[model samples]
Target: MKYIVFFIGLTVVLLFFFSSCSDSNSDHENKTEPGIQHESMKAKTVGIDFAGHDFFQPVSNSISHIHGIGYPNNQEALFIATHHGLKVYSNGIWYETKEHNHDYMGFQATSEGFYSSGHPEEGSTLLNPLGLLKSEDFGKTIEKVSFYGESDFHHMSASYYTPSIYVVNTVPNSKLGTGLYYSLDGGEVWMQSELEGLPQASAHSLATHPRLAKIVGISTPEGLFLSHNNGNTFSLISEERSIGTFFIKDESILYVTADGEESLLEQSLESDDTKQIPLPTLSEGDSILYLAVNPLHEQEISFGTVAGDVWRTEDYGDSWSNILEKGNVP
Candidate 1:
């Protein structure tokens, strides 16, 4: 598998995209008060604000195992989920968490905070395969949603405005089947999609509409497929083989594709109109892995590559500034 897990650092894409014009569907909200079986959480030795501002010493080593990226704190900070913990990039400086370093898999970032699933670090007492969880106060605390100690949803997506969740289960578990399943009422009930028009080939990437309930974009070796009826059926929208896909707007999407040369494109969902965006050149064999479009400012875009390189374009890709170079703190 080329792109193994979402690690959604965005929509956690917020996997590459996710908000809304309607009332939010986020019913399974976590709280600081004792409510949702947070028996395993232990006070960390480190103080709050792990490697946050006032401690802007640049990391000298290479940053690896980046799960994904997102625009948290209302597009003011960029949070990078990794195998170790969460890394923050703000004001052109990078920082790391002091204690909370759980390998955040299936990470999705929203305006409020983020939703993620993964396992605890080596000595941590949290569940081995942490179930779906959410955090509103940065990485300071977390709230359990569902499937605690039962599942680690690496392939997942959630609507930005509502609590609609989707995942492609790898195996049959006590609560879900081995296929694509989504829940509208939090995680209480899950519905498996028919995926009627999806290609027989394996899906490479997935994206969900930030607002729309039943819209999903599945990328395959064949092309990109759009399902409007909650994966009940699909239609091929693009023929170009894409590596990563992210929804930038309700009717437009940003994606990465490489043939002889790498390319970034923003295509309209309703038609074939696509405008190519300029991307900083990548090293050989390194391509973009994830994208995060600012929900507040659609003109601004950022992306990370397999080599741990992060870049941002403030003028709609007309120009770009390198935030991280091959995971190196520049």
Candidate 2:
């Protein structure tokens, strides 16, 4: 009887110990294991959390990471490139693209269509890293123009005068990866430019003159450089001003934003004078990350923020309206 009682007690103790161990293991798995959540997140339009949000009608996640912005011709919409996919805000209605939610790295919507390069979406059998892609129907379908698996452009700009012309900063391990590349007949043919006379050795952003065929402005780490004779050579315009992005508003004025400045600076190309355009109503801690001025209407401009917000000004930053709030992308 003593032996039987002792064995029963030992069995109970062992059972209790195993049960506690199992519960601990289960808890750890629940905390660390990604399971379906990780896989679901890979899809741009899957498993999204859209709760208690008044602005977001069909979006699952908040717009946090904005890469680029484009305004295609004949469309009354603004295509915004985000981490998830391309979003369109048209006619006061916000919509997220349904298919081909690939990551668009360098996006520019010209009169022709949308041009970009980046990685493809999850579960896609297409090229992992999309080289140069062109979408004629806005940001709906992408077709390989050139560099199918060769390069990914992070900084791309199109000439306003010529729709097929583009200037891009190429990725490494590609054919045109040495320096600045300029394409007159689209991405079909590329010419590696020497970018002579630039004081700074490196290039950041680039913009072509709206009317001039060969004139282009390049933003470097040091300052802004202007190339009057195509891209064969350049001349430093401003030494003290650190240019982040610049847009050629006609041939007389250049809209510029510095590295850490809040207000927009309008620099006269003829007089070489600078003036500040104030954005007084911007939310606290929100600064301009990107600027887009309408080619047809210079006064109508939109600026995007690093915090996923967008503001528009019809009078060139004098008065502003927050189109997309800081956390609400509608």
Model 1 CA deviation exceeding 4 Å by range: 5-61, 240-243
lDDT of 1 by residue, 211-230 (tens): 88688877766667888888
What are the runs in model 2 whose C-alpha is more than 4 Å off?
1-60, 164-174, 201-203, 281-285
Candidate 2: residue pairs that collide: none
Question: What is residue 295's positional error in candidate 2, in angstroms?
Answer: 2.9
Candidate RMSDs in order: 8.1, 18.8
Give per-residue lDDT, candidate 2, residue 201. Answer: 41
Task: Name the top TM-score candidate.
Answer: 1
lDDT of 2 at 5: 7
